[model samples]
Target: MQLILASKSPRRQELLTLMGVDFKVVLKDVDESYPQNLSPAEVAVFIAEKKARAFDEKIEENAIVLTADTIVCVDGLILGKPEGEEHAFEMLSLLSGRKHEVITGVALLQNQKIHSFYEISEVYFKSLEAADIRKYIEDCKPFDKAGAYGIQEWPGLVAIERINGSYTNVVGLPTHRVYQELQKLK
Candidate 1:
């Protein structure tokens, strides 16, 4: 079966390729808004499922469409992609010396049947100095990443103390779970 990845994220594409999966990237404009009453995990799943559903009429029976959404939650706040430098600074500050949840929701659709699941990884960050945060921000420019940071980047190298779950999930996608789910489809 051919796999269709409905995301433009380079990290997700790279992860899929690393899994030895032959997949094609298909882009669609997906509205990522979720209901406010849902939990962080639910929000992630909702967005992912929403993205998968966008390709409902575009895929064939021999194709499975995969979509995923990643979110960072700390201290009861969901930090989305930072809008600017100040926003990124605030998010990193909030995450300093704390443990946060990195949740990635995945959905697979074939023949209009949808299977969705979420993976949550607990990431512990050591206390980050203001200078370090500024330097990382200036050098990496994390405006496009959720929570204004990438777990596989400089922050992960220095600020992160440990992680309790799938490291790939923290990067963007839960690769092991994704591989397992794809195998089940076969």
Candidate 2:
């Protein structure tokens, strides 16, 4: 079956390619807002399923559409993509010298059925200096990333102390889990 990826994230596209999967990127704008009562994982999964369902009427019989949403949660708060430099700085500061969870929720749409799952990875950061945070923000311009940082970028090289789970999940997609789920569908 042909695979369809419904997202605008280049990171997800790159991950699929790295996995040697032949999939086409199909973009659709869906409301990402979730019910406030939902937990972090639920919020991610809800948005992911929402994205997949947007293509429900348009998908071909032989196609499987994959959608995902990644979220950074710390101290019961969800940190979304930063709106500006100050927001990014604030997020980075909050994450410094702390453990946070990066949750990537995935949904697959096929034959009018939706299959969903999530991966949560714990990230530990070293105590960061204010200057370092500013420098990273200025250099990376991570306005498009959840958590205001990319685990594969500058911060990953120096600021991160350790991670407890899938590194790919922190980057965006959970490669191993995604591969397993796709294999099942095949």
State how far residue 162 of model 1 sits from its true place (Å). Answer: 0.5
Task: Assess candidate 2 and give its TM-score to the true structure.
Answer: 0.98
> Where is model 2 more than 4 Å wrong at Cα?
none
> Residue 42 error for model 1, in Å?
0.3
- True lDDT of residue 82, candidate 2: 99
Clashes of 1: 0
Worst window of 10 by summed lDDT in candidate 2: 53-62
| lDDT of candidate model 2 versus the reference | 0.95
Clashing pairs in 2: none
lDDT of 1 by residue, 108-154 (tens): 99899999999999999999999999889999999989998998899
Clash counts per candidate, in order, are: 0, 0
How large an RMSD does model 1 have? 0.7
RMSD values, in order shown: 0.7, 0.6
lDDT for residue 57 in candidate 2, whole number 0-100: 87
